[model samples]
Target: MKINNKDEYIIIVGCGRLGSHLASLLSKERKSVVVIDNNEKSFNRLSKNFSGFTIEADAIEEETLLKAKIDKADVIVTTTNDDNTNVMVAQIAKSIYKVPKVIARLFDPSRQEIYEELDIDTICPTILSAIEFKNIIIEAGGED
Candidate 1:
């Protein structure tokens, strides 16, 4: 389902750089956002202007997912540093709760195929950085 309206709910797992950034952007747009992280200190990354539900708990746990109301979420984005943890949470969101959209951030590019097989959308910064670096080099004609 398309979240064109502000009332649509978006759940973000992990409050690190990527997760916090996404939550801040979505919150600024007035979208209903819920951010989960194991460490409460991690929530400090969020901007003071952000007005979204912050849950301090391990997202890999089913209980945390329940508290976050994963079932009613229109979209779930897992940005944990661990590829395995991201995969597990993504699968639960997609297969069990059947969230309409599930996105994950994976650091390892090799695991892209695994996430693809599970029909989970993934953003790999490593791969993106590599591609961007290559493009810059090509455009610079390999000049110093």
Candidate 2:
């Protein structure tokens, strides 16, 4: 689903690199955003100009999801470093809270099929990086 509307409510789980970047971008575009993370310091990744709300709590916890008001979220993104945690958060947002759109970041490409089976959208950096590196090698005349 597209997030062209600036008035949409976006919830991002994990305030790490990806999560913070998304929060900043959405916030800049005037979307209502809430970022959740277990470590308070992780929020530091967010830009100083970010105007979104932040909650220091484990996103895998149901209470934390409730506190973030997931029920009202138009989109939920899970970008924690751990694949399992990201999957759990994405599942909770999509399955339990019934968030309209749920996206997750997974480092392990092997587990992507599992999430896809559950109907959750995923972005796998590992796979993307491999593709980019393969392209670079091919450009350099390296054999496949």
Candidate 3:
């Protein structure tokens, strides 16, 4: 099938909480989305209104990405639980598949540098939560 570039094509690897939420949100925005996960049960986390495709396959496998049409993806997000898995998938999407926008969920803030060096964008929840906590403390006039 020919993918239309007019619509944003997003490929999400790992249908965990974050991945599923993103898929559902993007689907609601009417973006073309395909979610991939090894465990078929994980796909159930997606919202009932999610209008997207789900693929049950290990994202580490090249065949799985090929099936997802990685070459045609405009954006790819890797939200796997394992940091290594997320990095690997992001690298493949950016370096190999040449997807324009590649983002990976990183649990460790220290690894952000490595991802930056690889030219892959990362969203670190741990770091973000810490920043939010700091902001709240400051707003409360807590001691430094």
Candidate 4:
């Protein structure tokens, strides 16, 4: 399929494990992808697999987002380790940039509802990881 401005450009914040995997997958699918992170060390995840642009900066910063052209981005995915930062990034994407979609990775389950109230999509990796671990344990007959 042909992608254009109406197709929604994807901007992924945080270049850690999940962020890297997500960026590579999205880019591979022929979607416009931009990855950002505060620390340069996190970008190693995109070193080889990512075919998109990567920026080293804070996603919550308006300057950084502007530099990444967040105003034109159709979607924003904030996968930072900090829940507050993720929420702020999503808010800016939605309220400021008016991006159509924003997804945030939340570290604390307690703030999941708060994020939703703010109109930001939030994913709790801790809960998902725990569920996956339980499933694996069950599959392995509860063995270590």
Candidate 5:
């Protein structure tokens, strides 16, 4: 889902490297964002310019999602390093909260089909990196 609208409300699960970066970027674009993470220190990864709210909590709990206002969120993004956590939160956002757009970062390409079946969009860094590396090798005329 293309989140081109800056006015959209966004809820992000996890405040790790990827989550913090996304929250910061969306904040810069003037989107209303709420980032949730179990570790409060993780929020530190967010840029100094970030204007969004940060919540320290486990996203797996329904109460946490509720406090993040997931019900009215236009987009919910799961970027935790753990594949299970990401998919679980993404599924909740899509199936329970009925968020219009749900995006997740998946490390294991093998589990991608599960997300696809749930109709939740996933960004698999491992697969993407492999594809990029393959393209670069092909461009260099392949290895002998």
Candidate 6:
């Protein structure tokens, strides 16, 4: 659990579409990253695409976080499909270990406000999806 001062360490939980994309982009920026995903197969997509540490485990567990060196992390980003798990992991990382920054992915748009109120930055994929949907509808509608 060593954090190198030269680069900020970022922990990304979940290796699904969003997580994988974010991890790849961050790794491209040359940031030290440790990604945790329960499904071993989830990491397959990330293997060649990402140049960072990958851990196959639950991010909700403190021990898992410790193993990933959450205590030393500059930021913890929970991007799992499960909102509860992401929120819980964010809370633990923020409240317990007191990480300077915690970002939790919100699958449900309904919870975005609440997460923000709690001082956890939430990235709602639904919002982005809706915007994309709107653009597609507008483009197709114009052709008709």
Cα deviation of 131, candidate 6, in Å: 3.1
List all candidate RMSDs to the true structure. Answer: 2.4, 2.5, 4.3, 4.1, 2.0, 4.4
Candidate 3, 10: how far from true, in Å? 0.2
Tens digit of per-residue lDDT, candidate 3, span 1-144: 123456599999999989999899889889999999999999899999999899999999999999999999998889999999999999988988899888888998888998899888888998889999999989889654
For candidate 6, the per-residue lDDT at 67 reads 97
Could you give candidate 4's per-residue lDDT for residues 1-144 as a string of tens digits?
123446558999888888999888888777889999988888787747567888998777779999999988888888877778888888989988898888888888998887788788778888999999999989899575
For model 2, residues 90-132, the per-residue Cα lDDT tens digits are 9988888898889999988888898899999999988889999
Q: For residue 70, what is the lDDT in candidate 5?
A: 89
Ranked candidates (TM-score, high to low): 5, 3, 1, 2, 6, 4
* Residues 3-94 of candidate 1: C-alpha lDDT, one tens digit per residue: 46744899999999999998999999989999999999999999998999999998888999999999999999899888889889999999
Best prediction by TM-score: 5
lDDT of candidates 1 onward, in order: 0.91, 0.89, 0.90, 0.83, 0.90, 0.86
lDDT of 3 at 19: 94
At residue 136, give the lDDT of candidate 4: 90
**Runs with alpha carbons beyond 4 Å of true place in candidate 5:** 142-144
Q: Write the per-residue lDDT of candidate 6 for residues 49-140, one digit (tens) a residue.
A: 57899999887777899999988999888988899999999999988999988888888888788879989888887798899999999999
For model 5, how does the per-residue alpha-carbon lDDT over 1-144 read when each residue is reduced to its tens digit? 678665489998888888899899999989999999999999889999999999999999999999998899999999988999999998888988889888999988888987798899999988889999999989887565
RMSD of 3: 4.3
State the RMSD for candidate 6. 4.4
lDDT of 4: 0.83
lDDT-wise, the better of 2 and 3 is 3
* Per-model TM values vs. the true structure: 0.91, 0.90, 0.92, 0.83, 0.93, 0.84
Give the Å shift of residue 143 in candidate 6. Answer: 12
User: Candidate 1: which stretches are off by over 4 Å?
Assistant: 1-7, 142-144
Cα lDDT for residue 4, candidate 2? 56
* Candidate 1, position 68, lDDT: 97
